[model samples]
Target chain A: MISTKELSRRGFLNMGAAAGAGLVLSQTGLIRPAHAAAPLAPVKAEEALIAFGHTGPTSDEGWTWAHDQGMKAVEAAFPGIKTTYVESIPYSADATRIFRQFVSQGANMVFATSNYGDFLYDVAKRAPKVGFYECDGRNPLDNLGTYYVQHWYPTYVAGIAAGAMSPTGKLGYVASFPVPSVYSGTNAFLMGARTVNPNATLQCISINSWFDPQAATQAGTALLDNGCDVLFGIMDEAGYLQVAQDRGKKAVMWNTDLRRYGPDAYISSIVVNFNDFYVKQVGRRLEGSWTPTYELLPMGGGVDRDAWGATVPAEVAAKADAVRTKMMTEGYSPFVGEIKDAKGNIKVAKGQTMTEQELYHWNWSIEGVSGLDG
Target chain B: MSTWRLQRLPAASPLVSLSARLISVVLALVTAGIILAATGKNPLDLGAQVISSTFGSSFGMADLALLFTPLLYTGLAVAVGLRIGVWNIGAEGQFNLGAFAAAGVALFLPGPPALILPLMAVMGMAAGALWILIPTLARAYADVSELITTLLMNFVAALLVTYVATGPWLDPSGMALATTARLPVEVPAVWDIVHWGLPVGLILAVLLAVAFGFTRWGYEVRIGGSNPGNARYAGMPVRRHLITVMLVSGAIAGLGGMMEVAGTVHRLQGGISNNFGYIGIMVAVLARAAPLGVIFTALLMAVILNGGIILQPQGLTTQTVLAVTGLILFYAAIGDEFARYRLIRNAKPAGTR
Candidate 1:
């Protein structure tokens, strides 16, 4: 299942380049150099239209809900700004069509809350004046920028709390795919846990989707069956947290505060809020100062850990908070080398610290992290 | 007392069928409009917008054409199967394998575009037929229901396509994730965005109409489908005909997939089929499985699908669009049954006579 999901993640990532002549013939233009284009001209707030294409529905109460909250924030900030969104956009030619529809509708700015790859690139290349932002996107064009959260920082903090809370020191992770994001999340988490207990090991089950509550619940059960006391995952729901609550185990979540799902079992979540970011970007677009910018929202800014769950011991919370505060205030990074991969190879030399780029693209598992190697 | 009796006709007239379809669509729309009004949305305004956007601009037309091409292929595929009283529910899987095989040729074969294109087409058709081979065999020999066997292959095909497209065939550029690199060759465009695939599909539909309407093989197949016992008693090779017809049906759907990859998408990716194969079933049924009629039905389906896309920005979810389509199908099916009946007044009381 893990190997198959590793493939599924690939499918999830790249989609739509389907049967159409114009788009294919124009493929050469898709490889445009990443030179910075001039900022778009400003427009009146009331007249300006901003469109968002979300990968999932806003009702998801998780990843997409957070983004919707950000959209709402944009609305509140720029009172007269018109914001429209189409939810659950597939990674297919349909994405290209939706983005094209936005341009045709006179949208001044557009946000695709997922990496749409060529689908977005095709439209961005065609419309040079429209400002576009894709979340977790790699390619940047003159008109297209990309942004994602520095989620690993918060994930590390939650891992610290998990380390102190788990009596057995065995952590289980319900993962979506073996993608870079999952790799970084699992690695940073274990790196934090190992600081508390050197013999700590992490086991992962890739369920092949970013949001499959049933699969996640089963994975959590299997992990518990294997003696994992603390659970962590990069999912868009509280499936595992609910399972942990039922099974009386500790669990860490991602995307918003989900304590209501399982107050006792919930340790903390890698909460992401794009409100300020969206408002600022929209502000920039309205003022004609919007340049395509690559932003990795820092800890405490756009992404952070939620307030500790109710049942979390005060000492454990304080311990994790200290590490969080040090990272935020003193710029301390725990991703320093003396790091070894799962194969026992010294991936990062003892004196060297991994850069943000390296961390963002971490693909391999660290030592003592099993099941993700597939 | 006056009395009337209802009788079902052996066949519904073409005019009756056409009227039934039209009236059903209109009724479905009216029903949807009432629901929308109850929800406080202006259904009339929304309908106008859908019409204007779909017909007003060249872009919308191109979108329709792109959508129409696949339906044409898949529609004809299912229609052909229905002619022989078989249900090729696995057209989705066949379409995927066709695309997969064609993409393999595009990616792996070392040949010029001229030579490779035809090779890809053949490979695609073969793969699609191969995908249905087990189901076809079971139905022909062991009397297993092709509906169940064929339908089950869709999942397997989808998984296999997802596996290869994501694993071994993943684009190395890192620019694209779930798809292979763009194919070096593509089906040339005849219009702005419409490709040669549309023309090819149209031609195939016409050819099938001629063969079925004029040939002895077609007659035998039709007879075999309507009554296997009679055909067998008359010394017709019923099983062989069934096998051939089923394989041909799969090949047609496979060709659609091939065209989609080579002519339209220019890459292989999961969800590439976009439920076109499933939608084809509706198309075939609505057209009464007539090869000539499929062309028109496919267009109608395209209009509805494109309308859904246009209405998306207005906050209509895809699920809602599907519900609306289901309503149309339900009304159409009911209308078909209604068209089959006629009422006649009794001349006199039977006992008195």
Candidate 2:
């Protein structure tokens, strides 16, 4: 078990650290670099290049599982590449040692999948020859490339489903930390909730952790206790979804189709698809055109909409599909003008969509999200 | 009533005792190997992989020193505490308090290394000692359980550090993560800066071990811990011993925290410790609470742990690494058990091997 997440179960770490994002994005002011358009060819096809993975656990069956699948896909797609992974590595000095060992062992590419990975820059900057990717980490050094999932797009779509289906018009959001990423995702969910029902409000509870099954359960109960009918949970496990199932309520799925965990309370999930993004990065590195980047999942390239059980009606799924299509084809963003913060302060004016700058520095909870002022 | 019962024989020969310990260790390894094999992991050369990865090269060796320096401090602290019957379970908290204390000095009270380094050590150790002050006082005066009180104080320390880390002492530039500001004055290196504060750790460990062996207070502490009632009956100041041991244990463990901050990390972060305090318990147990033995045991534990990280790429999970450590610890405990009590059958079979 990854102590960073699992130790939260014991209630020691209340500050669910939001990875290396705090290292440079706002300081550098490049959420999306224009240099990403340049493509490179695969040069390592003839020779073996070892790809090393450092993450929490592939056996996690959640966020880490999704990344593991992407790694497997990359390994399978490239016939000449060999893959090695060290699971449940905490983001610390040991992490630096682990990375150095990977390099010494002849690993050409390394992917560290922890948000709390600013130290990866220390390791990557020193090892100039090796390509370092921080999975879901902030965009940091030139040697290190940060590839994060824009499950927010899919989260918006899930919000749409939750908006239409919540009979009480009160949705619950059990989130881990009040970071910009989670804040943005929950705001997107609230935006989706309002898309179908203008009066719908999301009651969000931050357990200040990422993976505490017990905390998730307690927060889920609190949200339900406060009259929230549909729940949306972030982080690796969906223990809250299981609570939703037991309570006979619907909750939106996250990162994976965890409907199996709580099939009875299933709502379509915002599945994370990183295969396309991973392949693109490795291809870029091989052909020597890799540039440091920080961008949301390229539309549908890194995130997708998944089917929930029969609990989610076909009409809700169709609406979610329509939004997903518009986002993929027409580049639709829910961060349009007329958006307001929790305090009814105008954040984005009419005819103005939120910029990546605003998104990166996201501080305020959007309108229709309650209970996070604490 | 059961037909059979355990009987303790007189002290066995040293060779017999040594063989029993070795046999227990071999048994633990075999058991671990079987479990790993059952779980679809290759048990072949597992230990080799760990060793080669952690202590394989010159750099690896230096890194090993860097990792184990804290273990040495914590190990010695626990060893010393156990020997005095203090049972300072708040080593983890003391370590954290020490880190915060060092950070406080570096951030708020700055000076050159000559002035600040010693100040940091004193403040850190004082903070650690203060962290155990209440619990130790309770244990000494009210006859409260040290184990529970110290354990409870650990939580207080964790929360206190987290509060300061995320609130007042937080690094303004740390991108919304739990970390304290950087320290200006850090412990310097001896030969290579790579090992950071490791040489100091070694010097401290050896000196303390020697003192524990030679000093009059050390002798008294041994007597106090081994038999507190006997110590009191002998007109020894048991209360004073309790307070002294608890404070010293906290102070040494606090040094472990400072080592990480001044030697390696340079800043206190959320991941400052991966249970260095808890692991020191294993080291103390393995060393039989002898300060000299603590140095070797902590080094051995650190090697096993650092080496085990290499096995992760070989399909070993953190749990797997922990299982290996646990098996070794189990073997060590069994060795201690056998050393304490010689096994004798109530009725020996006719053809005993």
Q: Chain B alone: TM-score in each candidate?
A: 0.97, 0.88
Off by over 4 Å in 1: A1-35, A338-350, A370-374, B349-353
Cα lDDT, model 1, residue A277: 86
Best prediction by TM-score: 1
Clashes per model (N, Cα, C within 3 A):
7, 3
lDDT of 2 by residue, B1-353 (tens): 11354455565466655566567657777887898789877677776676676667776787677778888888887887888876777788888888878878888885678998888888889988998898889988998988888778877776676566655666554243446656777787764435455666678778777777888887788888878999999988888988998998899889788777777777776547568888888788777687777777788777867776666677776676677668878876677566656544465566674
Q: Residue B3's C-alpha lDDT in candidate 2? A: 38
Q: Which ten residues in a row have the lowest lDDT in candidate 1 chain A?
A: A20-29
Best by lDDT: 1
Expressed as tens digits, the lDDT of each residue in A1-374 for candidate 2 is 22222321222111222221122222122454433333323357545465556444677677778888878888887776777787767746777777777877777678876665545666787777777777655435555666665666778888888889888899988876555667777888888888898899888777645666789899999999999999987857778888999999988867788888888888877788777777777777777777656656654667776765677788878888898889878777777777777888765666655554455445557778876543
Model 1, backbone clash pairs (residues 3+ apart or across chains), number? 7
- Among all windows of 10 consecutive residues in model 1 chain B, the one with the lowest summed lDDT is B170-179
lDDT of each: 0.84, 0.72
For candidate 1, the per-residue lDDT at A357 reads: 49
